[model samples]
Target: MYKNSIKILGAYGTKAKGFGTTSFMLNRHTVIDAGNLLDALAEDSLHIENIYLTHSHLDHISDIAYIIDNYFCKRSKTLNIIGLPQTIQALKEHFLNDIIWPDFSKIPLENSDVIAVKYSELYLNEEYHLDKQTTLTPVRTDHTVPSCGYIYKVNNAGVLITADTFSLENIINTVNNDMQIKSLVVECSFSSNMQTLAEVSKHLTPKLLFQALKKLKRDDITLYINHIKPSCLEEISTEIEAFRGNFKPIILKDGDFITF
Candidate 1:
């Protein structure tokens, strides 16, 4: 029913008891990450055409295993899993190697001509057109492992999502230069007390995030914060509240919808 669209399937900073990890559905057909794709989506909605993964982190790619298994019978064609070269390599060598999980790429589909999964290579800063209206570009991010954020632009609505990152320079530069960037979704995973851990893990805490924001040149951008560790949510919120900045980041939970 959505024409020019927006939707959020899962938005918890991290999974709580009954909740799931970080996966966000765009237009109900495209996935930002596969963290909790199966758990968060209904059977009908799980018939996604493309899954754009930010990185190969467990929490980022967790539900990829389940979706392929449960929906194998229903998938009409090869499910396109797109990411950077390193991300695709990691998935092949580590996650879907048949040792950890069954390689869906090797499995045959009911009616399709070939395999169930396809690993597509994407380079950092390269923009690919998904359709006439939608485009996605990956921007490199600083993480413990190889990671990249995504810029999804549909017509005039632009969403800049930093899946898991600590580096602000690259993101700042991109956001500052792109006039189409209207909304930003960033992560803050720890409190000020855990700033050291956040740094070591290449994540952002409220303190570090503030310091990172100093690199950006704009204040009019709408900021939506995600990836807050459940345990330290309160402390991180308090710290971010005291952050004296022009760009106020609004915390988002699971199932929140954003419209441009």
Candidate 2:
């Protein structure tokens, strides 16, 4: 098995006093999303070289703004913000526009002519080599916007992170085809009682999550559950415990670490 560490910086669907929104770090240099990154990494946030975004949602991309602004003078190299073309477009037009935040992509860094931030567009189902041992591939996911999930491969082993997705067909297919996938990190945003809101928002409840897990062919893989809405945590936890499945799902929280 390929040995690589995935550190959970923030795993909740929404931010509360103790719970933070979704974000994770691959090894140390690469961050999966921007949510709560500044708070989680603190001064070590400067070490982040690349950020592979799962989508353009605020909860998933919120810390990108702060990272750039807070570390503006400290960073020497351009921070690579990567995601699907639509995700990058949304960030450019809506979030990082000059009206809301300074367009750091265009502005030069302090004491340097090079820009502080750069955006890289990734295509679905295509693998991009991060290094000799790491690669990232984007997969389509059902969400309110043009969103997608990420398959992060380290050496021969892989981990699937389904960021804020409702549909599971693509996720199941990805797992079924790739025997190297050792773990899955999926979102369950609400409890069974909020099925209507979950369906409307294109998120998953405990009931919906179990229904999707029935399609997964793997039985040995570690199943990690994330993105539980803070307000419904108790109900969602109870609902998840009530549902029986082949794999026991572990509710992920901030600072949780997974090695595969």
Candidate 3:
């Protein structure tokens, strides 16, 4: 692993027998999403204090309930769940509303006075310093649900994450304008043959993805691709190779490290 890198804990669009869903580990104490925390880190998941969510989707937020449930008695620090306003609301209303999963926000840890979970809302393009060395900024993205991508920086170097989106307009402009961002993690979720379904679901196919990247004015930025549907992996990989013109995008996998 590099000294400065975003570890790919889970790099698939959906779960399979072996593949994990979306998640990225920023540091020992922080992660970008909760999809595969328990599976990736096991008891070390107890060290996680923050989860910066991209959206309210199941594949992105599934492990939140399990992580809290697994470490409820062992955890002392509150698990801070941060995201956009609507993302927070959706987690509270539909997912963790006490009907499906226990609302850990209301429950205190056995060892500490702090609640098991906490929520923080994000505003787009505003930078929030998480610690002395790290700053994260949210950016808008086009998805079926209200979602936001993240630009995480450390030591003045940064990586942009476009979690799950169909549109690359904001992404291209962001990378072109933000010199701090040296790497971009984009999603390519479907094959070229499934263009209609990808469009309808607000995901990107290889054909659409490269076609959109044709508008990217910068060539210095490294492109990393993720969130590939397990079923379409082979087909999508082939299409990506065929269509990715001058952009050499490395397809990401579980446990990969993306250094900015």
Candidate 4:
């Protein structure tokens, strides 16, 4: 069997040095989030057909504005925006409304097909089929807003992306319950010193993240860390390196790809 690789279109914690925000273009056409995607992809941005959003945060949904405007002429089909009900409602009421941005769902394409930005509600822990060989399940997480972590299965390999979570119980249970889960991408958004702000913002500092991971039973998972705040990259990296555990977390930078 051929291994499917995941490409990182944008992975910086912040938009420093002309780098975009945290957006992952999975397997070319499918995107997990849209932060900086329009800035990252430029003219070829019309190829994206599906976006599985984790939440309604600005950093996660910012590029939806540009993608609709810049590629409306080139898009041949509807762009499916898949997420939870709250996520969909939030985007519709706040971001994609005509006041903030044009309602692309009603806009007509050249071929008479309207630009479709429809929402599909994903239930907790239930696996939804994306294609013949790919499935994704949404696991609820403790964020300031309604958020979820994704369990993406492709070609028999499972990768869990804990998107902007602060809860330990959900993470522990998901890790212990899913045996097929081989790789993980978790967020550590702040240093240990920023614990108060991190908790208030419902984000995870290195201290909080490690304490949460202590509940997990797995000892043999390839852990990848992401979402480190740009201001605290130095402190966060040092804190993460000092972590003593069975699995050492790998921090991701801009344009890093992973194959498992």
- Check candidate 2 and list the clashing pairs: none
lDDT by residue for model 3 (1-260), tens? 55479899999999998899999999899999888998899889999999999999999999999999988999999999999999999999998899999988999999999989999998999999988888999999999999989999998899999999999999889999989899999999989888899989999999999889988888899999999999999999989899988889999999999987
lDDT of candidate model 1 versus the reference: 0.82
lDDT of 1 by residue, 132-207 (tens): 9888899999998888998888895788999889887889899999988988888998888887888898888888
Candidate 4's residue-wise lDDT over 115-202, tens digit each?
A: 5576667778888877888888888888999998888888668888887878858877887988888888888888888888888988
Candidate closer to the true structure by TM-score (higher is better), 2 or 3: 3
Best model number under TM-score: 3
Q: Would you list the rank order by lDDT, best first?
A: 3, 2, 1, 4
Candidate 4 Cα lDDT to native: 0.79
- Report the lDDT tens digits of candidate 2 across residue range 85-156: 999999999999998898889998895677988999989999888789988889999999988888888888
Q: Which residue pairs in candidate 3 collide?
A: none
Q: What is the lDDT of residue 29 in candidate 3?
A: 92
Candidate 1: minimum summed lDDT over ten consecutive residues — where?
1-10
| Candidate with more favorable, higher TM-score: 3 or 4 | 3
Q: Say which prediction, candidate 2 or candidate 3, comes out ahead on lDDT.
A: 3
Worst 10 residues of 4 by lDDT: 1-10
Considering every candidate listed, which one attains the maximal lDDT?
3
